[model samples]
Target: MNNDIDSALARFAGAEPHAGLAGLEDRVMCAIASRSSSSGLAMGASLSAAAFALVLGIVSNAVPLAEARAVSTLAPFGAPSPLAPSSLLLEPR
Candidate 1:
């Protein structure tokens, strides 16, 4: 068994690589370069999209709606109505 294993190992070590594996390194390098370039393009596109969304949000918030009215009350604007169920729970029973 040991002799058979030693012979098999020697045969494997002395074997020549297949012809189909020629220029494998060049092909692998080319594929890597192409993938890296595409990733850079994707990153740029995502950043530009985020910047556009941010600018749009800022512009939308800065401009007031035409149909909205300005109120002069001193109370907080978004406070819940006094008659609401949630507000009723806070009142003295």
Candidate 2:
């Protein structure tokens, strides 16, 4: 079945003169090569950097005792002591 269709298409195509693209293929290939050579990159790096910045900001502000290093007590992650004064208002009276 496919052979008959192939023969019919070959006969029909052979009956016509070949009308080749003057420079369209070359132009299209050049365009593809140029695009691949000087390509646009996805924004994964930018997004990762933004996420890192956001995490840093959140960590800096999230822990209330983040800056309390003077107190003797220490959390499991080596964080500041809960008894330490992170703010001026929390200093010993």
Candidate No. with top lDDT: 1
lDDT for model 2 comes to: 0.74
Structural similarity to truth (TM-score) of each candidate: 0.40, 0.28
In candidate 2, list every pair of residues with a backbone clash: none
* TM-score of candidate 2 relative to the true fold: 0.28
lDDT of 1 by residue, 1-93 (tens): 579889999998999989989999999999999898879788999999999999999999899677676564434457666667777898998
Question: What shift in Å separates residue 72 of candidate 1 from its native position after superposition?
Answer: 55
lDDT of 2 by residue, 1-93 (tens): 579889999899888655775688899999999877754453566788899999999987987664555546467566656655573467667
Which number leads on TM-score? Answer: 1
Once model 1 is optimally superposed onto the true structure by TM-score, how far is the C-alpha of residue 74 displaced, in angstroms?
A: 55
